[model samples]
Target: MRQRSSAEHRDLCALAPELSESLVAWWEVHGRKDPALKPWMFRADGRWPAPEEALDPYGIWIAEVMLQQTQLAVVLPYWRRWMEVLPTVEALAAASLDQVRLQWQGLGYYSRARRLHDAAQTLETQRWPRSLEGWTALPGIGRTTAASILSSVFNDPLPILDGNVKRVLARLKAHPRPPARDDALFWSWSEALLDPLRPRDFNQALMDLGATVCTPRQPSCTLCPWRLHCVAYAAGDPNRWPVTDASKPLPFQVIGVGVVVNAAGEVLIDQRLEEGLLGGMWEFPGGKQEVGEAIEATIARELREELAIEVQVGEQLIALDHAYSHKKLRFVVHLCRWIAGEPKPLASQQVCWVKPQSLSDYPFPAANARMIAALIDHLRADTLSQLS
Candidate 1:
């Protein structure tokens, strides 16, 4: 681990009293009132309607995975729709990859859906994992996610070191370094401060406090339950507690994206292999732009390499700039005419030709979705023009 400064060391070394009463009290007043916010529980008040139905392991697991990089407000509708469509582990396991991806459309991280599906298959056969080790052994469930599930369902005294908890604890400790830099120390503090008696409420309260009060910007210190206990607040700038080095400029890549349309007015899309980024999601066939290569040349070469076919690059459809976590991408999309051999799934999972209007039935990454929209609009305009 990287060395922490003297100030950082002092912030992390002290132990706070494990008093969660005030936090829990604050939660009762200001925590998320929606029952769906905590997926296992059926009621917003945290009261169990019935022991059997109160805790849906399947629902909680799905929610946890979706909630990984997404905010609660954004995931609510998606969660509700997902539950309505595929409520049980058996249902999820039985779902087709395309079906799962379609349901998870616009969720941003497609790999989570793929892993969730794989884990669901395992759980459907053997049943929900009882222990943290058992849960973490499954796909996509990490220490924090497993802890969240266990504590929420079984009231296990496991500590969660999620982003929210990290922020709250970092501020409380006045840690002058990012929590990610010293996770071991943060985990230790989390474990020490966890309320063993009411672990569920305690964990939820801390999460709520971080999200609602101890936010990344303009934190509501006056309303925070642990305001007095927060060392960063004492220092007078709570937002600056979890300090990070200046961010480096993200690298940019120019990519050639092709929207190949056939005479039947159907678009060709390929299923990505079930690994790496955007795995199992469908995308317009294209590749990275080689140095000094023209965008059209890059598209043709990529198509030949990927699908063993040839395409005549036609009108430029759109040029979109999208950013991933580490890099920026400039996708120069074009309306391509399929000229030679039949496109094959040589490098992808599968290749398909589908009507442009029915693209929603399949799942595409956010950038691909933009390409689809632009194609649809262009087709509509052409149709109106021909009619006129």
Candidate 2:
């Protein structure tokens, strides 16, 4: 752990008690209490439970994992749907990976779902972890996630350093560098400030403070509980703290997608290999377009190479851009007529031909989901024309 100056540590210690008290008091009134938004935190009466009441650890685990790199509003529906289906560890362990992926369809980070499934299976054979080390041992349960779950469930007094807490801490102390640079220092600060008796509420308050008041942009310092003691607020530039590293432009690639339809009117889709990006998800046959290759030609070539089938690429179905965390992709999709060779999974897990409407039965990446909608619309239009 990176050590801060002795004077800095002394100052942090001096204000830790008051900071925790003020934040927790503020949170009781302003913290997220909506039953619809936080079903895990409320009772049947749609009110917060008594402080001594226990929360569902399983639900807390699921929400924390889903909240990683995803916002709360977007995660609410998915979390509710997931809980409806696989409400317990045993249910999740028993569910197939395909079913799990289906539940996590629109969630961009597919690996998190996979890891949760794996962890659940592991837990099915053993007891739920009670300690920080025990929880961290589970797949995809990092220190912060493990701590958050433990503190929320067991009141373990384990401080969290999630994105929200990091920003809050960085601004509170007027950090000179990006919070990512000295994780140890931030963790130390978080630990020092944690309210041991009210670890659960204190941690929740810290995250809420950052998300609502000490926000990354245009923070409402006047509304902040710690504004009087916050270093950055005193400096008159809260946003200027938590300095960010320069970002590089994401590399862009043009993908050529072939929506090959057989004479029987079934479209070809394949499951990606259970490795690498978007693993285990189904997608239309496609590959990156090489330099100087016409998009149509690229589509035909990709179909041949990927599925071991030839196709006559035709009119464009849709052209859409999708950005992932690391890179950006522009998918150029086109309608195609299958020409030769039996469709085989040459570079994928498997290939199958299904009615366009049946495409919904499979789990696809977000971009491919858009393509399916377009394809379905196109097919519906064509059917109406023929009927007329």
Candidate 3:
């Protein structure tokens, strides 16, 4: 929305030419050579066979979604697996939620996977988004994501301001305060420095520069191509350029997880609603530890409340710690024997009794997954002892 003649635009105009030229040239040599960005867009000869070929929008959209709040290194394998499994938007749309969740089991943010499926269905009804506005209108696609997709796939000359780009721009300007305070300035600066001729390569180069060189910790300024143009480097403190806000203590919760198993060795699991954190995933039926209640009592209460059934809470199975983005969790997993009544989905979307061996087919959160591992190990050892 910012015009090139604006005052903020004028401030960056003088540096824009040199910045874009130098940055793109540097990218030619140091830019990430990974095909993760758009593997389908390249050829075996290392050059684009069809330079004008429209990129696979589905792949671009998937990569952008996976990359949100996640590092590229962590996303690479998941991206590869996803592409192999759900190569087309229509395939993703047709895939069951359970299958999608299984593929995204360890990806931390389960909501992204949900939105990806939702958006894939939406794309089937409509068409693959060709413009930034169209892309952002889809679920989970924000301005940065939309811009990245549009630029890389459509060569739309759109500017992106992801975490990496924000850090790079903030340091380039030597912003003494958090860039979030003046988002307009950072966005405008990113636009001013965008190279329209090669938007895809230019944006990728900028992201790589920030991720590899202008890191959050000690930046490799000496090897950086933009060191001479960086206001932060000139000020002798690149790390201080993007001013950091005071950190807040993350609140912690004590959870009680029940590994309820029947005589048939089937475990009780519940499906979370498709809304909040870890939505649409199956988990061992349990809840937060209530105040003044013992861990065992908490498990009994959670089972009674969550499922319309009573249980006898047994010994502790596993005690593990997990940290989410906003809260830390201390999960005290307990073995349990199902008793009294039949289990039903009282507070969850659904409930099921699955065999221990088939638990891998259902998607569970990281914390619940750990509990499953412990349960499997205990069951395997018990079987061995009986055989011996």
* Best prediction by TM-score: 2
Candidate 2 C-alpha lDDT tens digits along 1-388? 2355456667998999988899899998988756777787665576665556667789999999998888788999999999999999999999999899999999888989899999998898997799999999998889999999988777777999999899988888888788898888889889999998888888888888877888879999999899888899999878797889988999999999999999899999999998899989999999999999999999988888878888898999999999999999999999999999999999999999999988988999999999999998898899999999
Per-model CA lDDT versus the true structure: 0.84, 0.89, 0.84
Give the per-residue lDDT of model 1 (tens digit) for 195-253: 77777777878888888888889899999888877788999988787877789999999
Q: What is the lDDT of residue 85 in candidate 1?
A: 95
> Looking at candidate 3, what is the lDDT of residue 275?
84
Candidate 3 lDDT: 0.84
Off by over 4 Å in 1: 1-19, 36-39, 43-54
RMSD of each: 3.0, 1.7, 2.7
Better of 1 and 3 by TM-score: 3
Residue 158 error for model 1, in Å?
1.4
lDDT: worst 10-residue window of model 2: 1-10
Candidate 3 residue-wise lDDT, 227-303, digit = tens: 88787899997878688799799999999989998989888999998888899899998889978999999999988
If the candidates were sorted by their lDDT against the true structure, best first, what order would they fall in? 2, 3, 1
lDDT of 1: 0.84
lDDT head-to-head 1 vs 2, winner: 2
Backbone clash numbers for all candidates listed: 0, 0, 0
